[model samples]
Target: MSSPNELPPAIFLDPWLTAEGDGLKALSQTIAERVERQISSNLSQSARRDAISRRGLVVENLVANLAIMHLSPHLENRDLLAVATAKTKATRYDREDYPKRLLSGVVLAMEELGLLIRHPYAFRERSTTVAPTPDFAATIDRQRVKLSDIGRALGAETIWLNARTGEISFADRTPLKCRIEYQDTEETILLRDQMERINAYLNQSGFRFDGEHQGPVCLRRMFLLRSLSDPHSFNLSGRLFGGWWQELRSDRRHRITIGGERITDLDFQGAFCQLMYVHLTGKPFPGDPYAIEGLEDHRGGAKLAMLTLLSRRGDLKRLSPELKAALPRGWTAKRLMDAFTRHHPALRDAIGKDYGVELMATESRIMVELLLTLKARGIGAMPLHDGVQCAASSGGLVAEAMQEVTERVLSVALPVVEKPVVGQEWGYKEAA
Candidate 1:
């Protein structure tokens, strides 16, 4: 067994380790020089504040980028920074100053080194509040701005607009703006097209876009159903899944087991699934799929099967009258796959295998192509992994569809593995 000091093979590929290492080295030197100069000169309070502020800005920006990279597809700049700040603050680091500020400075330095993309929205100033109102009657004609208006102006879907002040508050809060270009290639164009189709499918199924939810309606409930139905445990521990093991070890947020065997609360798999869904649907997920722990039993294979059924073209004709009646209008196989994979690691891996796992170009193309197939078929399946499925509906259609899709996909993906019948008295058995 390798010692704790021994670096895993995946360490070389970790961007966080490389960036953080370089950042810490530079930060240490800079802090040392600054502190020495401060001591020698007896710097004024204002000067000290300025110095800290500058450092804070840098750290905030660094944390922002880290959050962006980790929380892609769904997380915007402001939200990313907020999450990063909260995460960093929860760690065992020194608390002499606002950790958010320090982390922002680190982020800024990293950006200067071209190690991260500076998200533009991170720095944009939200509209300011001029005054506060005493009561509803007094503020009735005060021209309260709706959240939608603010979101539209900022091109942000998830934002809290204060009705009285017209100030927009970001959930993933950070106050730093950096212009970063999202390179648009053929793949991005295709993904956009897929998003349009998915939107249409939802509309046809009588599921209106609820911006307040920040994702598809009833997405959380559908996810719950998927988790309940899944036979295999979605182990965050690395032992059960090899490639994911080393990556978890390097993440400072959660500790991996001493033997490099387990991880806790690292939700990259679910995050990837949500990212794929957003790419294909242009809708944010309602909640983090990785938040789910443990498992429940209640088969939803039939629902999953329906999702697979809808994903394919010309398959609609194959459905029996009873099946057709049970299925939601405009349901498609592609949408089912999209929703299933949002929390289904196996399906996510399968897609990665099919497309090649490069995030920017290759995988993006595969997701777009898959989405296009669903669009062509007029199916309303949302993007998900292999073992799960989901869709937006007014009532029980979401649950029903998920159950149907799960069964179909599992039967095909996880065929029966037979064990030889052992003698009643035999303690050990040998493979035939």
Candidate 2:
């Protein structure tokens, strides 16, 4: 609910950032020693020694995470690394690797050493946050950490379930992005194996976001599986998440490159609509799916209506103001729905239903097929919902590959729209 301008960026403390090379490992060791010495001098000797000794790895691991955050090209000094600690309810189902008890001590010790400024929970919803003090930055400065040797994020479990109702619910039940773990079955194993392979390729893909930072700004992209709506609802919405590029708007994402070359992005035109239509009717819709009477000039309205029609559950009821603005003036919600259904008669019986999850599952599988197909040829890409971002030189190949893979996945070749990085318009159609 809070706007981006309202709060400072909180880079979550990632426990997965381990010291990669021996040089960084030694640096973590050196930082851990300084923390231990400082804590030992201030606190009771036996208690500090025993407690710190018991969780040596935890202390260094915390140090490593903080170091990685600071060294990251994606971040500036003002963006603080927010950590969760000593809050039993907050971290109940969190992670076994980064125990709250051990981390709480490290946080306190670091604060005691004047290396961190701890912000107690501002509200019930937030974790206790911390920003490194000048002394801590000076410590990193003394170590001479470079961007090239900085990001070596070891891979971790990538398959996750998000039962947030929308990955939108921050309610206590699902809590913060509503991400929950799922029991992996044989089918899930297949999906996991597929995602793991994609992650592996991505780790080595050499893709960079090319942000304002002078150095390479790679965000350790490995596509993770996100099945939404329910953890128990296994086949519901299996979408690919975790690529940082997916977060960028098209204009900003124009800066992304694979191996320092300029980029090209290909989006499947009317992908999900095509998916649902072909899937339900066993044949593609004949005409332009967005074409309809009365709104011929406003294709944007027709498309948004089609989207809302598929995703909006329950009664048609009312249109949101944003939706209304897109549509013809003074048209009632029912009238717009009627017009849309009449135009695409095939989806008439399917209106007011929850096909959004089903469409995501269908689209994710289509993307997986395309991703794996490209990976096979050593062409790397970042998978969007119904499209992919790849090297500009590979644009033509990626477009063709997408056509072949979508045909195999959905039994119909969905149209693809090719977008060059420097282009003004949305995209040019590779095929219709």
> Which regions of candidate 1 are displaced past 4 Å?
1-179, 208-370, 384-432
Candidate 2 lDDT score at position 373: 88
Q: Clashes in candidate 1: how many? A: 64
Tens digit of lDDT per residue, candidate 1, span 1-432?
A: 223223111111111211123333344345334433433335698987776555543433233233222322232222212223324332211223333444444544444443333332222332111111123112211322121111101111111111112232353221222111233457434534444554445334321112211112111000000122233221111110111222222223122121121211111123243333444454334554433222112113334232333222232234344433444555444543454454454435334231112222322233334334444544343333221112212113322332233233222111111111122122222111
lDDT of each: 0.29, 0.68
> Which stretch of 10 consecutive residues in model 1 shows the poorest summed lDDT?
217-226
The whole-model C-alpha lDDT of candidate 2 against the native structure comes to: 0.68
Q: How close is candidate 2 to the true structure, as a TM-score?
A: 0.75
Please report the candidate that would top TM-score against the real structure: 2
On a 0 to 1 TM-score scale, where does candidate 1 land against the true structure? 0.22
The per-candidate count of clashes, in order, stands at 64, 0
